[model samples]
Target: MSLTKEAIQLITDTALVATAKALDTDMPTVVIPEGAKVVNLEAYGAFRSRFRGTFSTNSLLDFGKYVTDRAVGDARGFINQDEMTCSVLFNLGTEEAPGHADDRAVLKLKATAGYQAVQAISGRAMSQKDMSDWIEDWNSTLSAVGEDNQNISLVKAIAAVRTITVKASSESDHTVSETRASRSAMDAIEATSKETLPTSLIFSVVPFEGLQLREIILRISVITSGAQPALKLRWVGEEVQREEIAQEFKSVLQDQIGDAAALSLGAFDPK
Candidate 1:
């Protein structure tokens, strides 16, 4: 059956909420470059010829005659010799952000920890049966939440194609860095597995003021490269526009992300 408008709306809402949750959890700080330089070039060129003459016995062959004649001719024509100079300047400006180093460190630590967890899980003896079960459980959860929408279907299809490669070597005794790396890798895979709705839907739910929404959405599109598309929620006069219906969208997204987070953490009871 074709997707109903309500189904579309619900999918968009859930996707946006999930995106917002991701943003809230990882409030990425803005970064500006250290310095910028500008250079300007200006130049002028002119040509001039000079001649020296000594008194000659032959007046006809005199250099002074040639020189004086040309000078007198130019003077009669009111031509004046002049020089021109051009100047250029170079300027630089710096952009400094506060607490950037500390923020980077915290992010690095979180990523490392996540990687380690993934490594540990992968090293464990997990059978094909376990993987199949995991997939089934994930699908069932989505189905139970009325997420049979097109977006969810697409996500499931994509996830089915994903292969979780495990190393034969034991990962039980991993270094702190290795453990963090493992967890980080798994987190990335999990995020990749959930690509249902378009990115526009994600932006619709972001907590941005109306004027700022467009700019932020543009930024997100650039960063994500349209991996997750979102929709625009517009308003006209006193009436709420359907095309701009984002309140419900945000709510649904939040719920979906919460559910996904719980599942990833193994906090959700499958029973």
Candidate 2:
């Protein structure tokens, strides 16, 4: 979010050139006295030099940085604004004992959600501490809901039903977690089984902390798979909850922008 001395100088030079060009076109009747070095837009260079020296000094460093960032964005392009999207990663495992790679889930803002975030961030006037606290609240308040559990922390929610137990007619119950294990377990049970097992899984999701916890129930498809067993997880009926999270996230992003709009999250490169 900072510009180097060399970059500042280059941007200043470019601005000076554009201003000189505009002045030349607008004030063609103005006369440059003979023997004056101000002929050919030299005056603009002098003015730009003095302005750059005054603003780029240590006392006005912040102002200079702001001006430079604005100029760069207007003349070139924004780093994060164009994408209009923000991505969040939810960690399902504890800090010390992290879960598998698949345990992590990513949530990204849709186009409309991103628009709301942009509006919220740009419309707010906040201080640095306020922004920090807002972010903390956003992270800590997120929780998930299940059929049996309500308002459980997102980190503790089960991403998938890792294990299930099924009983055959004459054999003891078999428990399986992986796809291969489920396939093998089903093969042995189907030989004597008359009907497929009726089972459903509960999933909890909190799109944002402090927002509503959503419940998703995915039914196991044992009859459809025949000898093989698969758990396909998908759900509906949480559109309102998702929208509420998006709105709450907008407020958080507003705090993230704080007093300086240039300091917005989109100002940085994802890389």
Candidate 3:
């Protein structure tokens, strides 16, 4: 089934309104701004696959668009306005779609962009010496447990600081690439630190591809204050998720290619 322009516009307007709500900001009233632009407004329709007589197939539909805007300020934006975008996709699948038969729709609103300006703030301040001391403490804790006893010993270290809290400042002018890299770095640090004590780390980022910057927090809770920890990662934003990430990644790839094949690929990916 094909969607009409009016239908598409209505969907776009609703998605845009939803985007504003997710960003916790009001919709633009007058000027569109220098860097601001609506990237795409389109819809998709899915059909069921049944060759036999009147077998009821499924129809899955979605509407999405991205907005890019430049950040204003003196600080360098890690992600340029070129990197930010807004998107909304809804799954119109019904009960026939396997496990989610009863689940009618899955609506998603995401802001994927870059932040060039890094904000400066104060939180739990930890000096280099403090980090060193924590590391030493962790090592000592590990040594207390027999080296041969890996499993339970590791657990013990994790449990030692289940409530040990560390403060971190939000990132300034962060791009998606920079944010991902930062997260990867933190993950590495957590992995190494967990060898001795329970560790918790948090980081925030603003992608240049979208309007809002997303804050991500990761927690590693040591069960029983000594076991190896269980990890939990949370992302706080207007519209940020796995599917949205995938869509944005695909868009970036298409822009980089800018060829016939790339256009074809973009066609398949849509907005």
Candidate 4:
């Protein structure tokens, strides 16, 4: 999405805290300084509160960096640099009438770190289960990367983002998409749930055009279509390759984040 006039009109914010409440999601504690100066503090709730406004991806990343840098300046040494990353949630699918006389093109790009490394390890992309297994292996052993796939490293790629999912749809027939509420990702971000089940879930919204992306995504994701019930991580600036994805957008985000991570708390219902 671009930051054009129409895209600007599509901006919305519902802070993660409120987003959790509206969606009945589990909230996870996100570590941040109590009074860290933030650039977009006011706009944080635009996504869920029906207060549409447009801002670029870079702007959001900068705001996150501001907090991280401020924490360092304040001598708050409780976190790592990776914890400084930011995650943004938005939609790009639409139900434009396909009244055109001709067929149109569609592109869905997702990258899972395990898949890329597997392709590099072998000669082809692995199946979903295999990919999941690969991640499990890494999570437990942390030894999936090596001199395979021409030395393409899943560890390095995932370091940039935990998951990435890119979807473009002019039209879709799934009725669930039309009725499902947007998942309140923040609930997981702020949750301290003692229960084993999910405290929150993902939601949906009307997808519009003219949006912009500066590509600063990091850590965890949710795809709101209820039928699929999927999750994944994305690598910054990496173009997804059908044969050998560049580690850009990955699928089945369950493996990328820890149990306490936001997307993981959703209990990611598998497809």
**Leading candidate by lDDT:** 2
In order of lDDT, best first, we have: 2, 3, 4, 1
Ranking by TM-score: 2, 3, 4, 1
lDDT of 4 at 154: 41
| Model 4: number of backbone collisions | 49
lDDT string for model 3 (6-41, tens) is 787777666665554322223223212223343222
> What local distance difference test score does each model get?
0.25, 0.35, 0.31, 0.27
Models 1 onward score TM values of: 0.12, 0.26, 0.20, 0.16
Worst 10 residues of 2 by lDDT: 50-59
Give the range where candidate 4 is weakest over 10 consecutive residues by summed lDDT: 199-208
Predicted candidate 2 versus true structure: per-residue lDDT over 152-266, tens digit per residue: 3423322222222344444345557766443222234431122222233344444333334554443333222333333332333345545555556555544432333333244
Model 1, residue 191: what's the lDDT?
Answer: 24
CA RMSD per model (angstroms): 39.5, 21.5, 25.5, 31.0
217-243 per-residue lDDT for model 4 (tens digits): 222234444433233434323332221
Task: Tell me the tens digit of each residue's lDDT in model 1 across 1-271.
Answer: 7999878877766665455422222233222222211211112213211222222221112322332333321111110111011010011111352221110000000112222232233324333345335335434222211133234352443243243232222224334673464322221212222323222111122121211122111111111123332212221121232123234333332332232211111111112
